[model samples]
Target: MSLSRTAMLLALVLSGAQAGQTVVAIRGEDFLINGKPTLEGRTWRKHDVEGLLPNSRMVQGIFDDLNPETARQWAYPDTGTWDAERNTREFVAAMKAWREHGLLAFTLNLQGGSPQGYSKNQPWHNSAFDESGVLREAYLVRLKAILDEADRLGMAVILGYFYFGQDEHLKDEAAVIHATDAATDWIVKRGYRHVLVEINNECDVRYDHAILKPERVHELIDRVKRRSAEAGVPLLASTSYGGGSLPGPKVVKAADFLLLHGNGVKGPEAIRSMVERTRKMEGYRGQPIVFNEDDHFDFEMENNHFTAATAAGASWGYFDFRMKDEGFAEGFQSVPVDWSISSERKKGFFRLLAEMSGEGK
Candidate 1:
């Protein structure tokens, strides 16, 4: 019980609880991984360190306005060569840094950001995903290249297809409407099997971010699944919405797994409440639990929450952007990060969970 956060997180990564382990059905009470009655706390990281928001609504809410300030803060400036090679290289390096902590990287592609002419807005309009000006082939080739690197590294990439329209352009949930067949074709055509597409970002229910009506989101998945089936691939659609339980507004059957976005919830309070609430829901009683995105230093909560969730029968997904002294990885620089652990140490909290599961014994 006496261990640092870094040590604990690594334990989770090395816990021998992989994605495709055994038949421990996503439902029921207390699951087991790889035939062993071990807890499944899947520690991982995301590649948003360079300013792209993968699965968090904070970035979407901030960037939805198309404000220059948030743009610059996210590092999606109009600078850098207006091509995918440079873009891919930048992300590849970042992803490599994350894997060093024994975590998986999730990539994002915002529709707003692009290089010079590629972007519609002048100056800062350019973003990491401004493909309007870049050669279509160049963009596809480079994108696939980044995905290949991710696939090679055994990491997951949450292809950011769109963001909330908080900025001037204001695409938000409505952007999906403009997502033409060509774009959908591109998502399915030019990528490896590892590619997973998230149709929407942190879409709020209280405030409509042009959200794809739940039925539409559901339809989108069906369409994508059909296309993915033709290519022998499984397509994934996700959203970062508020959490209450399977009974809440976010309880839609569009995605393959259960996902939730977290704020800076104090300790395991929100997590515990979220789980209990989920258990009370009809379909989510024993579903796969994914903390798709959240703020850092929640290591204590992560450590404690993951244990609580699996015991109640579920799986957890951890994410980070940078490996800075891993109590939890930091995505944006402005968010002060604690260097209590090494930049590359991710086993701080989960490390204990791993020991409990008898991993590395």
Candidate 2:
């Protein structure tokens, strides 16, 4: 095929592939889907619920272990075999439940999070980008399935490109950059309007390359924004920080929305405090402050992280990981996840989400 003809055909194919179902955008401190504010005009206990995005960290939705040694570890209890397709299939099937419970968003990483939750070392190779930074088709196929479903349901996806533990899988700085460019191109060409690009999971964590670190990670955020802008897709981009840490001045300025984590934060009051302190930072210009990952949950209480964040005009996300004795139905980040709202903890979070989002109405 002629080069120009090939390019034209590619554009047509890409345009027809997904059909651009949902559109997510930021307007000052609010999130808008399809030109209207999220949860428009709603209030939860005197807090303005309009424009806030309630989310959860479900990073392993497209998870797969390439290392033979570790691949066997995620085997289902019933099947006694690990199946990446089944993992994503189950994840897709569970999305409606989450959406019905008033979840407007969820985080899914290209390089999946540590199946062990918090680990000093990650031996499993679970990245969607190869060492040379090329996109893996198998992973993208699964991700497309999830993103397509989220689009149909009007849910926004905080699509993350790299996780700290998995970023080391890329060979060097160039590979990281290549991976970012490639991922950005793919998302843009796919015509997904519901996707928010998170350049990396936590910029403050230990990363193999300096560019992916906190000081310079904003460069990648800007890169994604630039590339997407050139393509006319214009994805909203940001990188997150470690638990309870405030975003730096550089990212606060570059990012379209500020992403926060509440894992290391101690209490509900601390959660409220983090949101308060973030607004006072140098480059903060009233962008939507969203906690896309927080392991805390006290849904039955009078006040908790969720309550506190909403009260402070910030959005909150639930990060559930199965404890040592917990079963399949426990954690959303753990491998071989039971994506259903099965356990008490999962129920508590969704129950509160439903009540607040007025899904229970």
Q: Please name the candidate that would achieve the greatest lDDT relative to the true structure.
A: 2
> What is the lDDT, from 0 to 100, of the residue 160 in candidate 2?
94
Q: What would the per-residue lDDT of candidate 1 be over residues 1-361, giving only the tens digit for each residue?
A: 1224323422322223222212212123322222333224433331112111122111210122134453343343345212223334444454454444433335355442221111233334422233322223334444544555566655555565544331223344333434523445665564444445555544443224334444345555566666666765446555545433232334444555555644454445666666566556554534444565544444444355444443444334443344334322333211122212234324443353233333331
- Pairs of residues at least 3 apart in sequence or in different chains that clash in candidate 2: none
lDDT at 245, model 2: 92
Lowest-scoring 10 consecutive residues by lDDT in candidate 2? 8-17
- For every model shown, what is its TM-score relative to the native structure? 0.57, 0.95
| Best candidate according to TM-score | 2
- In the range 220-304, model 2's lDDT, one tens digit per residue, is 9999999999999999999999998999999999999999999988999999899999999998889999999999887999899
